[model samples]
Target: MKHVPAMQSLTPAVDARYQTLLRKLITKNGIGGKDSTAFVDDAKKQKLKTDESSIPLPVFEKGIHVNQAPPTSSNGLNGNSPTDDSTSDLSKTVSSTQDDRANDVKDEIMRNVLTIPMLKYDDLKAATDNWSDANLLGRGGFGQVFKGVWLNSLVAIKRLRDTDARNRELIRELCLNQYRHDNILPLYGYSFGGAEACLVYQFMACGSLEQKLRSKSHYPPLTWSQRYRIAHGVARGLQYLHTMTGTPLIHGDIKPANILLDQCLMPKIGDFGLARKGPYGEERTHLKVSRVHGTRPYLPDEYLRSRCLSPAVDVFSYGVVMVEIASCLPPIDRNRPVPLLSDWIQQQARDGLDFASLEDRLLQGTPHSNPGLCREFVAIGVHCTKYSRGDRPTMLEVYKRLDNLEFPGKHYM
Candidate 1:
């Protein structure tokens, strides 16, 4: 019997059994001599494999031991150690997975911040204080206008209850004309999130010209000078829209309610929801003239008969508003059934009625109570409300006429 080394006594029974099994495995695998020594040396250089199937063995005095399972291509086992390439590939796969997760997180964050699908209902509710009745400013055929505060700034919000196609078209047209001039209301934004559509505008403190004209206590009537200034301002605004912009904008629904006043009583056109761009060239026939789309009392005969409306339609509407400003009466007075405003004006012209009555009673105390200037304004209104659209002065002509008019104390040329 061979004398076993003293170091072998320190090995466990399982280790000794594994060594015996490894010897048998090496012989069965046809490993011997230098090849056997090489396999043993390779095995001794590595730590033990964690798998229970791997045999354990002690190092020889020469630091060599028989390999139970040497590195083999078939089993992917290599002396109880992983290859450099295999370890690197596994690390790369883990790193790529981490990178993909990071990219997914980044994409999700961007989608949340940048793109807003539609205005949220909660955000709108909070902005408008749940549409409180106190916020109500005015009502129209379409719906109500409300005062709202957003980001600590006052804003006017127009909510449309009517879902008419014409109303939708009007909203689209107004949005397109946002940058035309300061005389037109500035559209800050709009929301169509819920069943109802709402438009947001820079708030005008003084409200509409109609409100000022009809108010008794909280609101005061406009003086003749203020009225003249408003008329000129509105005419200039309309002229700017009709001629100066890249595309002529027609205020299809020009009325007193649509004319808003700023803090200094400067007139600014509002409610372009019914506005439309004029047809080009000979295709003017393509323009649709609805049956009396404007106020009945203010509707020109050409518009009443459904004739092709030009910018003159707006002129006609402005004329009625002008008359209303001068007379302090509603455009249509159902109580006095004598004639429509146009007919009454024609009769006044025929019978030589004094034009002084046409001046607003509120203007009696103002320094602008000059009968000569009042007559010029009445004449301008008369020309605007003419029976024929051709006879109505263009907004440009209106602006020039108003610009050249001389007041009692001030002269404009």
Candidate 2:
């Protein structure tokens, strides 16, 4: 409940200095285009060294990747070639060696995938009441979600349509297993039968932030205070995902629907099916992807145009979500001049639009009415959704700003 002064209301000189500090941090952390090639080259050099060290010993036998000095005339190596039988045997040996290496790699990956508990398919089915419609929570393109009770605790079972996506499901589970944060949705277990795969997660009573924000009649419209809390929690979660993980992760799809609210209304970021590892080194700016897989409105222009993904994509999506939290407007609102919520918010911020004009109507007369905080929060979102990916602030910067906001409730770091 500490009250900190808003940066947006400060003098122009102070604001400039603040922005300069953010830029310095971004450059120091190698989050921009500068020096990216150097980082990549250094990483490639290190990888080459590792590869050379791990290279198998040269096979001296004939026709099997032999690396020997040219044979002398006394040895008759120049004129004589290996017999057909010897050649066939060498080829088979090489093929067998490759198969063994491939299997070893596959086994290692499977071991990592099995870090989480694997529940029996029958138990999951029983918990969901044999997949009854009454226990069904929702459905998506990949699968359906069902509410269930397992081991005397509530859980959500995401049952896939078929076994085709089992590999993807396991990959997601592996990613979730490595992530442990209060703002991250916890994975309970998974079940893979011969026909289908199911991923179990901790159940959230309130459902998604999208449902609460969009479906006002079914669920009470979130107050301004609640929205602020959700925004801060999500920012902290994204920051953790970007930096705290051994390797940074990009949550490709970061819309409101992917953000779940627990019983106490704490926000937890979920849905890792589209999540991908970021660049290898701290100095690398971005990673190029062959294809993009995220909602269009939440994607930045750089990613959509070049398919080069970075942590900026998530920042852009979070900005759009922030605008929604502030205005209660959908991402695609044809009624607005800009149409796109992120773009509209960015425009408003650029024009120094008053927070009052963009504030959610329901916030009026509420105890959460703090004009300075609202303006600063919206400004942070605008900074995040900059048109140029490099121009967007890092999640750490966003989190620090949110952490400084003054509010009545106890803050969770």
Candidate 3:
């Protein structure tokens, strides 16, 4: 067994930002003569009268970048709001002080997100044939994806729709470590191409799980063995994110489309723009977002009511993905009223439909000639999507259970 050091941030530039903001706040409040802690306490007592964000503070919230509303904390203690309890001047000032300190921590983080060769716009343009339609892979809400070559290596580059106000915070959060996993996609580097911002990542030759599931010819529906490996790999990737060396990170968006496959049919989870940190120095295991994002079927019942997110949410999404992987079904089929595969499958089970009936038509063998293993794989999926968060298993548990299920009886890295 071996260990690699987790990445650490280096933000000397941000270290001095707090003192500057602290002095500014002191001067603005005319509290230079008073003790800082005492002044803060007195200010907390005063009620806020306005709901305006007139103050420009360098506050950072997970998944929020430029032009996004600050996240509203579950307890209403963090985030910015347009109401009395949320937007009071005292609260704003106090929150800003904390934000400034956190910003320094974030600065060092963004600096080391990815360390690799930089790619200029010219390089990307040349590789992508000047962003030609021929190189275009697909277009989505975030931006357009293209297949290109740089330094003799193929790469997938995302050209964001809004260069100025998108995903910068995510890039920094990702900087906390270099991702090297059998399942997670590798982020090469990002670039500012004059009027646009683009992110570069290793090219997955086989496209996405959604594409393959939708059309079997999208390079052959994966074999039962491949599906088993993909399932375990995706689980391992989720576990890595949840219990990695650093703070727990919730993938926030987990779906088949977000799961890209390499030439060998290995799945790598991508699209982290909606990612979030679970908690900070608190007993809570979840955090609220500015708003709910991600596919509805994959979202848990609580998230539909409130935007609160935790590792369980990721597990829920993973379950949906696992269902699709096993049954070759979409997470949501609009043709059905319930739409969610979990709901649909559960209904079938209620009617006494057995495990053999649940396998995807394209899959071969008894999931490596072991019917119990096949049932267990799908059973784990069902357990992961339990309505109550407490009932759902942790990703580590899910991964271990699947790992023990066996995959062609070979040792995996």
Candidate 4:
């Protein structure tokens, strides 16, 4: 791996370049990632396959949404004249509009009181053979996800250890119907009052990204194209969580283990057990806590110290994940002296270490690839993991720049 310059080597030119890059991508007018139709189109064009027995993506109303202000032109909905009966008609219209809004609010409340699909303990026992180790797919912080057949199709059942503490996640999942994005994993339902309190989801054909990265021998090393695509997908998912959705979600846990893969090798952000409804208006999002939930390396310093939870923590974790993906290495290897991929990469970059060699090291035998693109991505990761949350770019901005990145032979201006 290439070592960038240490902090001491950050010359004026390097700082200027970095600042210039950020300014170029982040326009002052508005957010950068609002228009990403091109990138979504490119992902659709990718024709990668994975090892699965005829897998299919669940259709969950992942439709296009556009949020715009009400029109202000005369003779429009707001236009009104007040003469004789005109005033009476306008009052009636306003009253009806208010009534309609009240009804919509009532409907929203009913939606939150959703009727979750319940499953009996007997059914889960039958499917998992009484929670047999043979059926266990993997374990999580608060539960273990078991692979089992449900209603003639495969499903992942996460058996929660603490139902009282973790039930909120299931509620959040249901509420995120307004927050649903294609790259986000869908929650099928939940089963409480059963022997095992659990949440159900569509089984990811290729499993978690962590599995693929670790078991390179079993699964081939992901090509640069694949990694790039995965990065973009993950970013869009985060963007949806941060901005696109009505209720902003702080995923709390953002790591490769939470990122699952589908039949086409596409990425899906999963595991909302630690998710929380983000702050709004003047509301403070920071939480005072004695305990923090997350992987050690991925947790930012602020999160550990003040327990001030924010979307920036997820962004920081994403930065670490980015480093891992680019270098095709784990966050930390105990056996190796220099552990924690993001720190090492950042230290190298700060020290003016030659980043040129990162491509050959990370990309391996891929003779046809884009090193410039890889370097730029690494830079983004470093910025995300910055010590100050104020410095990190919003998830939308991250997606915008990433989408604009050109592939090997292509040129864009």
| Most accurate candidate by lDDT | 2
Each candidate structure's TM-score, on Cα atoms with residue i matched to residue i, is 0.65, 0.72, 0.74, 0.67
Candidate 1 residue 381 C-alpha distance from true site, Å: 0.3
Report lDDT (CA) for all predictions: 0.59, 0.67, 0.64, 0.61
- Give me the overall lDDT of model 3: 0.64
Measure candidate 2: CA RMSD. 20.5
> In model 2, what is the error at residue 360, expressed in angstroms?
1.2
Candidate 1: worst 10 consecutive residues by lDDT? Answer: 55-64
Model 4 Cα shift for residue 30 (angstroms): 56
Candidate 4 residue runs with Cα over 4 Å from true position: 1-110, 113-115, 174-178, 245-247, 282-290, 334-338, 360-362, 409-413
Clashes per model (N, Cα, C within 3 A): 1, 0, 1, 10
Q: lDDT per residue, candidate 4, 324-347, as tens digits?
A: 777666788776566777667777
In model 3, state the lDDT of residue 155: 95
Model 2's alpha-carbon lDDT is 0.67
* RMSD (Å) of each candidate, 1 decimal: 33.1, 20.5, 10.1, 22.1
Error of 3 at 166 (Å): 2.0
TM-score for candidate 2:
0.72
How do the candidates rank by TM-score, highest first? 3, 2, 4, 1
User: After superposing candidate 1, which stretches have Cα over 4 Å from the reference?
Assistant: 1-121, 166-175, 245-247, 282-292, 365-368, 408-413
lDDT, residue 145, candidate 2: 94
Best candidate (score: TM-score): 3
Put down candidate 3 lDDT per residue, 286-324, tens digits, no spaces.
554434666777888766554456789999989888877
